[model samples]
Target: MICIRLFQWGIFVALSFVGCKSEPQNQDQKSIEKGIERIDVTEHYVSDSYHKRHDGFDWVAVSVKHHGDESLWVSVRSRADQKKPTCTYDTKAFRIDKNTYESTYDGKRIRFEFFPTSLTISTENPDDSNMLYFFCNGGATLAGHYGKIDGELDTQQIDLTTFSKVLNLQGIGFNVSSIEKDNKNTLTIFTFGLENRDYNETFTIEGQVVIDAEVEDLNSDGSPELFVYTQSVGSGSYGNIFAFSVNAKKSMSQVYFPPTSENPKINSGYRGHDAFTIVENTLSQRFPIYKEGDTNASPTGGTRQVSYTLVEGEAMRQLKVLDITEY
Candidate 1:
């Protein structure tokens, strides 16, 4: 199940919910809103060829746990090419996040010359709009960290088709929000896609690109690691897992297949989540976490269990799974 946190103005409802049950809720709410600052958000994405291959939906991504208030943040650009990702950050009309700081844009290009009307704004835009957008929302939710861009901004007509990018998924229509390089060559990716989102065999994540992916020397190895997420494109739910490699020299051989157990169903094919990293810098936790069923139970359900780990050189990887279900 996905999680949701509501926000009134700039303050989180939870902060008020439990904090002010018997107290004056509206007063606390007004005080928080009156803090008088600004609020901005940024959402990034990452995916692979398989995510964009079949389903049009490449991957899915969402902002860090926020109050989902009237304010909104729209992703503008995250092209597949790592060398040239143009996220609209500096524009006054756009809201952005920093990789290391809460106040600054994460050093990306944000073209918001097409300010106000450039975005359909709430009324929720398109279900597939991946670009990050900012909403001042009449400036009522602006927090301290929130600040305006550097220069003039306006609405300039550009091809809407070029605004598209592909992504990947986990648990089907799922997408990860954060993928921090762990202490090891492994990755810790947090899924912040949608709420109550589930993966049925019929859903897929496609046409999304992961941008600004990097790793830190959490272990002080001098070399930064690369972390990535997996999003399915065709015929199934997207954003299934996260994956990694020690380096170019130690890449593992992998495979994908339909279930063929003695009591397998007829047309049921299992979707795979990416390799998970249970620990760090140990080259450990390497395996597949999946749910499967035979063709006979295709639409109704499938069989799923703890599969085997990826047999690495001289070592065996372990699998860590929280839950498994099929549709």
Candidate 2:
């Protein structure tokens, strides 16, 4: 009877060992199946060649098919080349988060956000922060930056073409008036609360008409100064630039330009097609100067380079002038 009992125990132990071994085998099979499923899903959404190929300027071509609409396509080039890293993504349904769009694929995620003049893409991995991309709207260049954060990818895109038109300059408590040109060769500027409320000023340019106007912070102050470039109606390509600064009271005041007598070496009037540039709190302009009888279209003179520095008392005074030289 004891011998019979030992034989039964041996059989039971062998069966238990086989059962434990088979259980692990089943688990291994399931794990393999799951890995295969992940690969299939990844392949369905992204090309097999792109997998693990995240490196410099990774270009992503997103092809989106919307219901009852023609297919939409967009190509994004990573900004990694610019030291701003970003992650790449296959086109997928996205959710809006505040001013951003969020999307995910293959266990990775991406986010896009927009600023007044730029768009940014971010990811969770710090290493991925170096990736960056370009987004062009209506052929206008929209600069981008990259960073990393934890959470669902968030993205926001703006029709930059429209942002410039509908942007609320008034919502920020600053009001600007349109530049008006009068028949008398006078340019009138009106603004409210830029320096003082209900401020109006008229600038007289003898024979020039206002052609372009832009606002820039030449002094790198929080407030931007206005720059108006004028062209001679009679002499094509001949132009002059005028700059205005906002006073403490928000009043638009003209920034000073040195008189010809003060700097006899540099040309008196501004000319050429290139606008002036402000760098390191200094404004500079280099352009060809036509002789008395020469129009910009038929220049027959030397070029003048002038530089100015922002001096105390809210003025831009000539800092240095180079002798006029042949172009």
TM-score of each: 0.26, 0.37
lDDT of 1 at 263: 18
Once fitted onto the true fold, the runs of candidate 2 whose alpha carbons sit more than 4 angstroms away are 1-183, 195-198, 204-206, 259-262, 268-280, 289-302, 313-327
True-vs-predicted CA distance for residue 172, candidate 2, Å:
7.8
lDDT of each: 0.24, 0.35
Instruction: Encode model 2's per-residue lDDT on 1-327: one tens digit a residue.
Output: 000000000000000000000011244543444343111010011111122234421221121222112111112222223332232222222325333444332244455332322224455454543232212222212122322122211122100010000011221122222222334466656554553454456666666655434454555556556555555556344546666665553555666655433455664444444335454455555566667877556656666656665544533422334333345
What would the per-residue lDDT of candidate 1 be over residues 1-327, giving only the tens digit for each residue?
A: 110111112211100000000112245544544354443323222222112423432211112223224323333322222222222121112233221122123333322111110111111223312223331111111111111222221112111111122222221111223211221122123222333432221112244322222222222333222233333333442333333322222222112221222213322343432222223332121222243442322433333433323223433222223234332
Worst 10 residues of 2 by lDDT: 10-19
Local distance difference test, candidate 1: 0.24
- What is the lDDT for 265 in model 2? 64
